[model samples]
Target chain A: MVTYPGLPGPIICDYLSREASRGRYGPGVEFQIGKIEMVANTGTYLDSPFHRYAGGKDLSALPLDSLANLDTVVIRIGGGSVRAIPRAAFQDVPVQGRAVLVHTGWDAHWRTERYLSGNPFLTADAAEYLVSQDVRLVGIDSVNIDDIDDPARPVHSTLLGADVPIVEHMCRLNLLPDRDVRFFAVPAKVAGFGTWPVRAFGVVST
Target chain B: MVTYPGLPGPIICDYLSREASRGRYGPGVEFQIGKIEMVANTGTYLDSPFHRYAGGKDLSALPLDSLANLDTVVIRIGGGSVRAIPRAAFQDVPVQGRAVLVHTGWDAHWRTERYLSGNPFLTADAAEYLVSQDVRLVGIDSVNIDDIDDPARPVHSTLLGADVPIVEHMCRLNLLPDRDVRFFAVPAKVAGFGTWPVRAFGVVST
Candidate 1:
């Protein structure tokens, strides 16, 4: 039902399962699904402060309001040649106390080798600007909000250090209006776990 | 920042770890701190069909849409003394194709011994009525939507078997207006896993 124009269908990475050969519950079988088998961060994900800060709240300590019912505003910075979105891009949009979802439309490359290409991203200044605005959540339709190829990764540090949750690998932003939808990207609650996969989405009134 | 109005506060739990003694890379030491242990269903959680159905999509196969961006309407029953919500209670509510959030104010009992006793629940007929309305999601603020003591769990079957996700252990329904908010309850994508905790909340326009 989610149709994207000018893009291939959404790619859902098939979840792989490793048959238990031996484990504690007995030699017979033990299904250690999340912990042992998959990447701690995969699919759509939420990055918490623990991902960047030394003494930050793990997934368990993340406030429920941090991930739920956030007033969302999506900024459309399209036209193929966007390298990094600047603070000026958000000039008239309200950012305080809301989830700022940047619709880059880069998730169209999910799962394919192209997903890792030079996708649109937020500038370091833009991230600092968001934190200055007291944004609760920042989400992107790209591989990562930080330039993945960048060794410094300023976006992750600026945002996560402020305890602002970031959602990456999001699909279907094309279905959303630029400024009216509600965004949610809830991470798992584990004492020491900070970054983990999440099923993030937006709800708009009809 | 999430100050709960009453007793249990918010039963929504969180777990995030970075060092693990056990996992896929195997026992001794692993760099990735996976979620090694937690209640299968904890915090704000979801009850998928596989939680109760023998042949159903496990947590991994469940569609992302089932847990995301649901049009929600909270029906506030049990104003004072009423405990059981019957099918007739929802006759006037617009339930078709929406997430029906039943707020019983029982979230006030979370984490206390009192939470485990005499919880309000929906009747069997209420479950049938919801299915008839083709509801996308069903949620409640209690520990469980049905009387957990009831071995049959008709509400679980009728709703989950229809592939409708059920969110439990929510707090702060008192803060939301009945019909204007959108609810989101999302779970992790772990293949073959039946259930996991969730952070469910509603969005209201300011």
Candidate 2:
């Protein structure tokens, strides 16, 4: 039950005051850790099928195997003139049963206004292609996996509906190699609570 | 930026609606993939110094290296008995520069009311002892790392003030060998947000 020592984003502060407060539960001093708030969509997080489909599994129902222990491939799409990511971007990559990381270099714009505009996103065809590959997960070093301006949001619907967990708001993808890195991005195990924030990370071979 | 697959939990129904509305710019729809509204203390979360100390490093101030790629060790506390987790519970365990995980059997009670009952926790002296060891992190498989019933909350104060991370409400610790498990439990990268929820996990030798 130990955690890494580090700083948290704004969402956590909101959570500590809202959900983690021990105001009720017991004596004013006895903090039983209150009911957590904050949408599952905050910060570096994972999106499950429940995030899209009406009948999809929630965070607590998701299996652990899907969240841990899988081979990973990072596609370094840094320094690109392209605005929209095309289907061909992942054509040559081996994505089956593996975690696919799209390094759009947009993480540098995190917490900034630019990170939201014209950021890199997977084309709908790419989403369908990834589903076909049986890829375990899809992550991006950008704001959202889908284009924010698009009303349809087909990319998110397609991937999440297929039971593929989405990891967004990720930085430091540049620190990982193209292959052999095992990716992990697991959410909390709250019953009936879908789409909360997560502390996603990867493990490179020693 | 790929992710692992997961089973939908009980709260998937509400999760879908909550996540989809956030959009991408403010908060994406697929971030926290689960369905329950958990406290920040639920499911292997980090406790920063701010959780106890009035003027300690919040989640955002801690270093990334401190939470990732840590050298870890495990101290076995059988059956989660309070007497089992004594000041001497960590004796002879190399503490300096190591993440220590105390294996208590309470994880088996996850999702049940018993998981939050009069569970085992470290005595204040035990907390001071670990601090003396200069351990990097401390974790346990129980409700709270310290007895919430206590007014002072010394265990939390001692470790968090020293910048050691504490992971609480963890499960499946029995799956890990006493040693050789690389533990990782990172929080959101939120500045001034100290107590966000996390998906704490470990990598076992394949």
Candidate 3:
């Protein structure tokens, strides 16, 4: 449970321990039911429109196609020190109606002190570029898609404003190629809940 | 959030409310980061082997193939009055190597007083039958997949003992056909946790 530095990490506990369940089940049959308490932004999580706007769609309102089984495009930001990703990087690729994954390789710093400061983030101009291209969803391997120093979080506002879902804190972007990838990061379909963690994965079809 | 009876429902609050975020972000730009606290067996949740066996695989150890893009086989329990789903209902279906979703029409009682008792469940023999056939996963559109009166809970024991995951409290099974459906109900990749909610859906291939 990799929560942001200021927020609380996930607390996982056993509601019905296997040892305690022996009284409920047979001698050889026992089950352990767990309980979790955490903020929705912990670890790899997706944001629906409702995260940014009150009148926007929540997790239950999102259609399945918007979150699953779509052609993907990965944008690589090399040099390892580029903190502010600009719009120039997204100039001319077939990004319309695709899931764009920004591979910053910043995930190497996950759970470390290095991840807390001067992390890579997408600029507002880049977000404007993506919304202009009608991207279905945008994801990143970094902790927050927006620059924490900037108060507005323009990337999240711009993307979620156009009904484009965002997935943050993704891992294994290097495992994905530049093309022919299909990404999935569906949140639990709970009404009034706008953000939650997901088991984000991508499949490359050769 | 549809938690089981006698348990608390999900509490969804804002960790970062849109009203509060105005101080952080610019005017007209605000984000709402939600927080949730609930038992792992809430609505449409999946159980890993660790839910039943302490040494068994938890959510982090589950391979994606076990939860995604699985060829599905829906076994319809018609007549709307069958309380106990037997192995005979699963016979004559191409269930091997596929996700088996048992439709007992019990979801119609969801969120109602009727959903608490006398609901549908799979017999222990039915669980053994599917495990013998090497079923990849088993799901039910019911609150509990085992007879609550039966203290042993043999179905959960047998199926989870064989490393076959289970999905419960699923809805909308009546909308699915008998075959050519691909079911996906992936849990969050969390270590030390054995159960969690999922946005379960099916893609019917034409």
Candidate 4:
């Protein structure tokens, strides 16, 4: 659902035949192979420490505890008056060792021009607070965690520099409850790479 | 770890600066954006039902019960003499409502020329047995689940056609015990797509 204004959309091309065709491989075997060409930041993606620091851990080195089956807390910011999320927003929530997901309701505008303009973002103080709280991961249902117009990207610097992974361009946060949920956002264990797209989701206990 | 003899490898490119560089964005902002391009079958991947059947469920429609946090069992086939796995292999193992992972020790040759030649595969009877057992998912540590020379792809046809997902080209099964493990192999929820790469893993209860 991501539509970065200037970035290339995901490209899916067929390599093998889907229908029965006369080919060198044979006719009865209708295998469909697909080639995907897209930016790692194309869709809902996770950013490892290497995404910001050259010497930091990449996606492959990320520990499973930090990416899988984590306690989660969802914060609703869509109905709030402020766009710049502050430390006060998380003051009452237990964030330590949890995936703190900020539901901004911006994903409703995904794939539209409005999604690219003036989306909600975390303030530097909020990022610094989360880092100090030892949060395992942070996710937002918005285009970027930091303001796109801000050149410094203080949020990315503070969080990623502290080895906390970030998940952006997420959707369906509303489908999850406020607490007692397990979150997962595991990325491909690709070596020498910083950021990669992920299948991010929250597992609600039935 | 997947080397599709003639297919292109993953491409990782920089979209932003890693260090302080004099660019249009700014010098102080040290961000590294990455662009990835590869075939969906580039590495360890999951196959949805649509991969084999046009009218089947795609990646987006796959239920989480079939992909995440299911009880798992690993079967070691490396010590066996036959490359074609038989139904007798699972006679003593409990496979219903579980992820049946076959460990062939072939991943030792990953990224090598020998990894692609004459790999082990499941026989048609084994596939039928798994389907009848109502296994949640199947994973293999070899190049493919079906013999590459077989044009009909009976294993894939039998499994995927029955809505049984398959994970291929996996590694590190040796790190997991034979049982008491939870397996996950989730693909991106892309609509209309049949298959995609995944970050497959097994979770052990400590």
Output the number of the lDDT-best candidate.
3
Residues B89-199 of candidate 3 have per-residue lDDT tens digits of 988999988899999888888888888888899999999999999999999988789987788888888888999999999998988998999889999988998988998
Model 4: CA > 4 A from native: A19-27, A78-80, B17-27, B78-80
Clashes of each: 15, 45, 0, 0
Better of 2 and 4 by TM-score: 4
Please state the error at residue A150 of candidate 3 in Å. Answer: 1.1
Per-prediction TM-score, chain A only? 0.80, 0.82, 0.97, 0.93
TM-score, chain A, candidate 2: 0.82
Q: DockQ for each candidate? A: 0.14, 0.27, 0.82, 0.64
Collision pairs in model 4: none
Ten contiguous residues with the weakest lDDT in model 4 chain B: B19-28
Ranking by TM-score: 3, 4, 2, 1
By TM-score, the better pick of 1 and 4 is 4
Q: Which of candidates 2 and 4 is the stronger one according to lDDT?
A: 4
Index of the highest-DockQ prediction: 3
Q: DockQ score for model 3, please? A: 0.82
Off by over 4 Å in 3: none
Global lDDT of each candidate: 0.69, 0.69, 0.88, 0.84
Ranking, DockQ, top scorer first = 3, 4, 2, 1
Rank ordering of all candidates by lDDT, starting from the highest: 3, 4, 1, 2
